[model samples]
Target: MIVTSFFSLFISQTVFAKNMYRWIDDKGRIHYSETVLPKDINYRRESLNKAASVKEVVEEAKTKEEQEMEKRLVRLRRDQEKIITRQKVYDNALLNTYHSKADLMMAIKSKMDAFETQNQVVEGNLIRLKQELEAQQKNAAEMDRNAQKVPKKLLDGIKSTQKQIQELHIAINEQKEKQSQIKREDEADIARFLFLTQSLTEKRKGTSIPSIKEANELGLFYCENDRQCNKAWEIARTFVEYYSTTPPDVYNDKLIMNRPPATDTDISLSLSKIPLTDDESQLFLDVHCRESSLGKDLCVSQKVKDIRATFIPYVNDALSRTAQ
Candidate 1:
């Protein structure tokens, strides 16, 4: 019985020794053994065959912080993907909705006209209701002067008229809000349409140097290649941020811009990276002011002209420095 038990122990030892397990301990020391311990199971490990070649590798379990960071990265990527998808949908709708800027303007005008007509009707009704309310109030006051009890019907009419006035006021306010919202939406659509169509049209025109007047009007900076444009884009971004009175808004590879001007004097700046060819691009700077006469004047002022004039030189100097 003793001999048989010894033989069995030898066989088990030989079988276990056929493969080796290598792992790192908590102290980051490497260890190799014929068998892995339960305590070392969570550590990153490798299994080697009899030839001493790695047969399998197991990654270490992530810590709590590592796991949380991974989850956050995943969520960020998902949100970015959602934004991209939504933008594509909007672009498609904008392209399909109108053939040109004129069409878009016409559509906007029609909608505004309808709203204006509705508001006029509401105003007329409000005037009539107020006159009626005034007459009812006078009748009530006369009854009170005579020391007569005002009828319940008259009192109820006064209350009803007051309630109608309150409701009409709310409706008028809501209508005005709607008109403002419509204007904003239409403006956005127009801007996007102009960008999409203009970029395509300009790309077909090929790269060319514009005249001083054209450059000032368009705020254009030409680049001969992708490398130059990439460098120029960064410089253009700084220029936009520095000159724009409004806070930053949308930023992406193709466009960088600030929020629309809130006051007549405030200037909003934008840069569009338009592809001229497979290897060439142009950075276009645009200045915007509030949608008022004063704002229009501000956009054409010397201050704005100076801003546009510097765009090309600013980018050129930046590129020259980088080249050096």
Candidate 2:
């Protein structure tokens, strides 16, 4: 009887040899059998040898929703990669272009001075053209008073002077706009440079401060997750309202802003919430002044700098208190 039982066990093992299969059910239970049931055919399964080593694996079929989610994840990853690439390029340019913030400021001043000179020249021409137009008008009026018809040449001269004056006005406005654009671009560059250099310095020294001056200079606040970011957004909105001279213009989940500055003394503030990942976000604050010399000076003023510098700390303290 013992010999017969041993033979039967050996036969059973041989029969199950390469035909053994392992699979997981919908409830996540592991199952092993010599034959796969039709109901478990679509589930992920593995073929096993007599030694219980996996011989082959068959993947489970994905649902449409799962496939779509995978596609979205791929696209999101690609977009994130592109953003990282662009940021690297910007950082390299900032580091290579100027050695110091003062140097960058000087370059901006030089360019702005050139624009100012051009505008001055346009103003001079405009004044001369106005005088010429007045003279031509006087001649035409004198001719009319004497009951003489105004000469076609004189009329044409007045029209030409007026046109030149108009052109000069347009040119002056364009130059002012260009100067404003330059200031905005240059200030942004300076802020970026400060941030990069500060980071590099901290890395080299193997130390980090709780508050980064560069972050303050750039008017940026960072949050590690969505909950903190949402709370920070409200704080940023209040900060903008307290500082902005312009009235509110837009308010939304991703952006909060005030109208553009209407006067030289007016300051408009805007905040944008940028997502770095599902959990991480950045709040960026921007200050806008009028497109004039006074307005430009205001942007770089100590008062404005203080407002920016305090933003992150304000949010940090508020969030900490709430947690407590």
Candidate 3:
């Protein structure tokens, strides 16, 4: 009975428990193992039974610094997604709100007219309330000067009239402020609406952004002929991240295609925003080498020189800290 129970338990664990140890090696490649990890390596435990993609599982394993970097990346991706979702919602709302700039202008004018008419009513009431309160105060002053107690009803009337006048003033100011805000918002909305609509029309007519894969292919075109293909793959992964996130305007004028109709010119890239940090940037930039008949590969771009200049010092600085 004991042997049969033990066998059943073993079978259940083998079938149901798909525990995995995920880790990144010194070379930054992600690895997954079912039973044993490398003799000296630390791994993060993961359950493969869960619906996690291989990419997500790999991302789950990282060093402390890598984890912080990933956190920042996740936050940025979330913020970008929100911006895209908000843009879609605004685009829909814009379409439903008005048919043309003229239509929007007319709508704004009508709202302005309504506000002006309401404010005129409020102003007239405020004038009347002020007059009544002033008259009541004068009456109370006259009674006090003659050494007589102010009439209770008259004092009450004065207080109530003053309150009404204050309330009207507040209402008028609030209404005017809201109208100004609405006009400003409408102006911005119309501009954005026109831009978004125009872009959408152009996209429908076939002018569209390049796909991330296409951008990666473009970067790989120059590096794909490397002897082992290691450098090319690394460059492709880095380019994929860069192309997907960086604004096209930053490099639209300076796109370097390695195997184009032009000769090899070392390109220097400076972006308004760099998605990779110092170390992460070095990891990809360090892979640039071309096979030459003279036995050793010479550097092509001054950009690569800059990378080496900064990366070596950065690594040394980090190593010094560990030594301390």
lDDT of each: 0.86, 0.84, 0.54
Record all residue pairs in model 1 with backbone atoms less than 3 Å apart, i.e. clashing.
none
- Which is superior by lDDT, 1 or 3? 1
Residue 119 in candidate 1, Cα distance off native in Å? 1.5
Candidate 1 C-alpha error for residue 22, in Å: 4.9
lDDT per residue for candidate 2 within 213-268, as digits (tens), equals: 77788888866568888998998889899889989999999999999999999989
Model 2 / residue 279 / CA error / Å: 34
Candidate 1 lDDT tens digits, 207-243: 4556546875678886756888888888889999999
* Candidate 1 segments whose C-alpha is farther than 4 A from its true place: 1-26, 32-36, 45-57, 198-324
* Candidate 1 accuracy as TM-score: 0.54
TM-score, every prediction:
0.54, 0.53, 0.46
Worst 10 residues of 3 by lDDT: 273-282
Error of 1 at 181 (Å): 2.7
RMSD values for the candidates in order, in angstroms, are 17.0, 18.3, 17.5
lDDT of 3 by residue, 252-319 (tens): 21232232112133222232211122221212222223344221223444444444344323433444
- Candidate 3, backbone clash total: 0
Q: What lDDT does candidate 1 reach at residue 293?
A: 99
